[model samples]
Target chain A: MKIHEYQGKQLFRAAGVAVPQGIVAKTPEEAARAFETLGGPIAVVKSQIHAGGRGKGSFKEQPDQRGVVLVRSAEEARQNADRMLGNTLVTIQTGEEGKQVNTLFVEQGLKIVRELYLGIVVDREVGGPVLIMSSEGGMEIEEVAAHSPEKILSEPFDAVAGLYPYQARKLAYALGLDATAVRSAEKFLPQICRFFVNYDCSMVEINPLIITEDGQMLALDAKVTFDDNALFRHKDVVALRDLAEEDPSEVRAADTGLSYVKLNGNIGCLVNGAGLAMSTMDLIKLHGGEPANFLDVGGGANEDQVTEAFRIILADKNVKAVLVNIFGGIMRCDIIVSALLNAYEKVGFNVPLVVRLEGTNVDKAREMLLASGRAIIAASDLTDAAQKVVKALGA
Target chain B: MSILVSKATRVITQGITGNSGLFHSQQCRAYAAECQPGVDVFVGGVTPGKGGTTVDGFPVFNSVIEARKKTGANTSMIFVPPPFCADAILEAADAGMELIVAITEGIPVMDMLRVRRGMEKSSARLIGPNCPGVITPGVAKIGIMPGYIHKPGTIGIISKSGTLTYEAAWQLGRVGLGQSTAVGIGGDPINGTSYIELLKMFQDDPGTEGILVIGEIGGSAEQAAAEYIKSHVTKPVAGFIAGQTAPPGKRMGHAGAIISGGAGTATEKMAALRAAGVVVSDSPGGMGDAMKQAMQR
Candidate 1:
């Protein structure tokens, strides 16, 4: 659900929030053309990826090359784009494996008089959305909160009302903005907060929110993420999802109505509920086995979904063992056992498999699995399943 | 002496006549009948516009208020769909139900946030907009947990998941320990009731001796619960935090089960629980054992 900086800016601009003029470029030619079209003395070519800390990120191919660079001309923009596009970017947020940059954003550079941070998140403590502002911009907010808590100012706002204009003005003044910039923030802050609520955004962050030389406030960088559960109401935002930014196994699992997160391990987990699945993974890790992926078939998954889940789990070559943990409540264990048997027949498990079934008709499920005898280990409980999976992997 | 519902608890089902609503309603009634000879704890149902009607031998009312008034139902279980489930919960709250159990899932976080605000003005305590509801072993079966696995006893359990609650409950049963009341707090970021509330209730309930809390990665719920346990709880507490192997920022199936902002990780929650003198179980399978160990100490 994370969108690139350019896409975020597009959302921002569409919402009437001030942002530097920008063009999304997919190639070096497009980036160069965008730079030329802007006719700017200074333009920024930024690699478009979901993760933050892009400015400090470096290209893997050319270690010296930054993912984001200021270019003065079309040729320089093109050269930077050439180095950035189709290259892997490693950032503090992206980890060492990095992400492939398939898109570039060319934006007109501005003379930033002052830099501030603005972030809106669903605060667990507040039980609603809260807007956090800090004068220490362009730095990690968590770090700022840790080192200098006084520098951060936060206010919880009603989701329907958005951030009040007076509150926005207060934050602007606290950020050391001039009278003119504070006036502009009354409009800018509330408008952006409206954009966030309207889009069902889980997070909207603008780091280094700049005051231009002309005293206008603009979002220098926008990092936006929408609530996945709220995507049903906003198809337009769903269309903005970039599959290139996600794991293929995860994307495939989602298409089949499964919640799958790929990890670097050998044991694959298939559980009914989120907490149980996580507990199963933790137990596997506790027993000295790494989970290859976390897959939850959900509460009421049927035979087809189970089969697809198996296909998706086995699709990962790194998966050396498979553990199926289904805590069937209203969904009876006997029915889920039949589904598991059917899925096992279709998927043809190559790795050692352990299945833990609990709840309604559990005895029936155990008998059915034992009768099927398809090279699957039936675990007695969660710990038994974890131990069996770890043992199967020889961990 | 369960914390919430018991054999004497009368229940009303909202969104009854809907597939899941009617089905679980009947199942809950059947469980109560089995637990208490010839008695149905689920008195009636509410399906708005279906008043003065009967569905599957259970009288249907137009509203929760009508059902509560007519059947003397003091608790309400909701199975309404996501969009309207929040309103259904508020309706139950408005009707002055002592306890409202919401079994519906996928209720938008926005709706839950609104529900949280609305509940602040009401006295009715709520549990699970996306949960398995409450079960007091043989006394009452209010929501969706399979009734067969639970047994009546003194260990009070609170969990953020449906099936994980079952896992812990069944594990306790296997170890010859039983639950006084096992409550699913639901696995959403904005749940109606949380660990702290249920933990305090369990701490005060005389029937409940040991406490078991099952939590996953995400939010400060576990941390807050641990802090409460440290400051106030005198009962032995056994705890388990899932998603130890979970990667940062990945939502592990549940919307709330994500490690965000480099906070709300399994390690942090585990440390908090351990520091609070809680016997934190490393394996989900060891929950009952953890409780046994905690009680022994």
Candidate 2:
């Protein structure tokens, strides 16, 4: 549910939070046109990806190019966009494999007198949304929390009553804003808090909440993450999702009603529940085997979804074996067995497959598997299933 | 005596006319009927429109107020859909139910946030919004977990995952360690109850001899529980956390199962629990043996 910086800025603009004028561009020509449209002497071309640390991130193909570049001319903006778009970006957040940047945000650069941080997060321990303000900005909040905890101040607001004016003023004063900037922050900070509550946001961080030389407060950067469950109420926000930034297998798994995360290993795991799937992976590791992926064929999955899951797992060339562990409650075990058998018949499993079925007509599933005689190994329980899968891999 | 539900506990079902509500209600009712020192757990049902009717011989009331007024039901189990679950919880709280077990999953975090705030002022204790509820084995079963897998003994259990709760209970029962009560606190970022809350209850309850916790990667609930156990809890406790191999930042099919800001990883939670003198098992397959080893000391 993490939105790109451009999308987050759009939300910030809609919420009356001041942000620099920006245009999303898909090509170098578009970047040049956006720079001209802004009438900017200085523009920042930021790569649009779901991860953070973009300003410090570097492109894999062009080592000289950064994910976020500051250009003094329109031609430099176009050049930066040309080097960034369709290239892999490796940030602290994006891991070593990195994500591809398909779009760029060409925005007007601001002359800042001071940069501060403002973030709203759902603080579970506090039992409500907490507003975090700090004098330190443009750095990872975690580092600030670890090294200089005293520099940060937090205000917890009641979800029902929401952030009060005094709370915002208190935070503004705590961050040591000047009188004029404090007056502006009094209006700006509450709007951000209100935006967080109104939009069903899990997190909203405006890093480098900048104070201009003229003493006006503006959000220089924004990163917003919405609650996935709350997306049902806001169709507009759901449309902002960039599928290209996500793993294709995970995207396909979501469409197919399965939860799948591909990893580096040999055993492919398909389990019913999230907890059990993770436990299954750990069990595989304990049996001296590594899991290639984590797949949960959620409750009430049919034959086709199971088949789709098999195809997705087999698509991974590193997977040496498949482990199917299901403890059905609402989803009957017999149905899972039928789906597995049907999938095996259609997909023609090349890897050694181990199946463990439990709960709700489990005996019927075991009998069906035995009668099929499809060379699929059946397990007595979770432990047996893990041991059998590892043994099947000849490890 | 169990921590929550026992033979004396009276239960009411919300959204009883719905498919899952009606089905699980019957299963729970049948389970209570066969349990030792048999109890009638399903006292009434609540459906907004279908009041005064009956679903499979259980009386249905229009609202929680009417249901509580008629049946004297003290506990309410909700099986409503995600959209209306927050309202259902509020209704039960307004009706003065002592314990509210929300069996519905996928409730919006905002709704839970508001509900948690409202419950802070109310008297009722909420168990879950997306959980398997609570079960006092050989006494009263109040959730969707398999009744056959549980047995009444000395071990008390609290978990965040539903099936893993069953998996642990089944494994413990296989090793002759029957449970006193097993509770699933649900896998939501903002749930009503926490491991620390239940740990205190288990510490005070005399029937419980040992405790088992089934946690996952998410939140600092386990860390908080570890801190609580260090100074407060005296019982030998064994813990197992799921998602040891799960990649960071992924949701892993549960909303509360993500690692954020380098916190709530399985390794971190396990290290915390181990440092608190709680035996922590690496694999779910070895959880029972770990618990047994802890108890032996």
Candidate 3:
């Protein structure tokens, strides 16, 4: 649900939240053209990736080149874009295996008098959305939260009413803004809160919410993510998703109606529920087997989803064994067994399989699995399933 | 002797014309007949525009007000979709229903937040928007969970996961332990009730002897419940925290099931429960045994 910075800025513009003018470009030439189009003496070429820390990030191929570069000329913009595009960017957030810079944003750099932070998130404990602001903006919020916790200030707001004008003005004043900037913030901050509510945003952070030399408030950098469950209502936000930034296997799993998260282990797990699937993986590790991935075929698994689940697991070369643990409910154990048998035939299981079936019509399911005459190892319970899968892996 | 529901509890079905709604309504009616013959626990159904019609021997009403007025139903089982699910819940609450059990999954958190605010001013108690719903073994079954596995007994259970709730029930049944009442609190960021609220009820109820809590990686509901158990709950308590293998910030199928800001991990929840003198199960496979150990202590 995380949108690119350019996409976020576009949303900001639509919401009447002031943002620095920026053009998203896919090529070095487009970046140059965008720089010229902006007609600014100083332009910032930012690598567009899902992860943060782009300003401090470095390219893997050209380590000397930064992910975010300050360009004084159009030629300098193209040079930085050429070095960044199609190159892997390593940031504090991107980990060792970094993301490729397929897109760049050429923005007009603003002369900031002061930089401050503004964040909005659904605070689970508070049971509503909360607005967070701080004096420390350009730096990582985590560092500010950890070190000088007093510097960061936040307030919980009602979901329907949103952040009150007084609350917005309070934060603006707390950031030590003068009368003009505080008045501007009273309007700007509430607009951002309204934008967050209107768009179903789970999180919206404007790091370095800059104050220009002329005393106008604007979102210098925007990071926004909408609630995935609420995506049905917002088709436009769903279209903003960059599939290239996501793991291909995960993207495929979503399309196939399976919840899959690949992990670094040997035993592949396919279970019915999210909690049970995670618990199954934990049990595998507890029994000396590392799970290759976490896959949930969901509560009502038909033949195709089960087959895709297996095929996805088997597709991983590291997976030494497969564990299928289903605690059947509305979907009977017999029906799941039928799906498993059909999926086994379609997917062609190459690894050792350990199956544990429980709940409604379980006896019939166990009998059917035994009657299948396939090389499926049956376990009596969850722990037994974990032990069998690990034993199958020879761990 | 169940906490919230018994065989005498009257029920109404919301979104009764939908696939899952009609299907589960039929199953629950059948279960009611099987457990207590000719009870007629399911009094009416609610479906807007489908009013003045009879579906499967149940009368459909347009509004919750008419349904409550006609049937005198005390409890509502909702199967409405996510978009209108909040409205359905509020309608039931506004109609003065005692209990509203929402079986609809994928309800937007904002909708639930608004529902929470509205419920604060109303008298109705809500259960789940994205949940399997509650069940009191043999007497009343009010959800999509398979009814045959549960039986009448003493272990009071509350879980965030649906199948894991069934898993614990099945495991407990295997060892000759049956549930007095098992509740699925739902796996959403904001639920109608919390573990602490339910635990307090379980402690006060005589039907529940030993308590089993099944939690996952998400908010600090489990930790809060653990603290409540240390101070208030004298009953033997056992706990299980799922998703120990899950990475931080990854949503594990469940919308609320994620570790963020270096908190709400399985390890932290387990540590909290352990420190509270509750028996925390090492693996999901061992929940039944852990509860037994707690009872013996």
Candidate 1 Cα outliers beyond 4 Å, as residue runs: A61-64, B49-53
User: What would the per-residue lDDT of candidate 2 be over residues A1-36, giving only the tens digit for each residue?
Assistant: 888898888988988988889999999999999999
Name the runs in model 2 displaced over 4 angstroms.
A329-332, B36-39
lDDT of 1 by residue, A113-147 (tens): 88889899888777999889998889989999899
* TM-scores for chain A over all candidates: 0.96, 0.95, 0.97
**TM-scores of chain B alone in all candidate structures, in the order given:** 0.98, 0.98, 0.99
Report clash pairs, candidate 3. none
DockQ of 2: 0.65
How accurate locally is residue B175 in candidate 2, as Cα lDDT from 0 to 100?
84
Give model 2's TM-score versus the native structure. 0.96
The digit string of per-residue lDDT tens for model 1 on B119-201 reads: 89898989987889999987888998889889999999999888888888888887888989999988888887879889889
- For model 2, how many clashes? 0
lDDT of 2 by residue, B1-297 (tens): 788997668999998999989999998898888884445678989999999888899999999999999999999999998889999999999999999999898898889998987777899999997888899988888878878888899999999888788788878977889998999999899998899889999999999999999999988999999999999999999999998888887788888989888888999999999999999988898788888999999
The interface root mean square deviation of candidate 2 comes to: 1.5
- Cα distance off (Å), candidate 2, residue A262: 2.3
What would the DockQ be for model 3?
Answer: 0.80
- For residues B1-297, what per-residue lDDT tens digits would candidate 3 score against the true structure? 788788668999999999989999999988888888978998879999999998999899999999999999999999998999999999999999999999888888888888888888988988886788888888888888888888899999999989889889988887788999999899999888788888988898999999999999988999999889999999999999999988887888998998877778999999999999999888888998999989999
Ordered list by DockQ, greatest first: 3, 1, 2
Report the number of the highest-lDDT candidate: 3
lDDT of 3 by residue, A4-89 (tens): 99999998899899999999889999999999999979999999999999888898999999888899888999988999999999
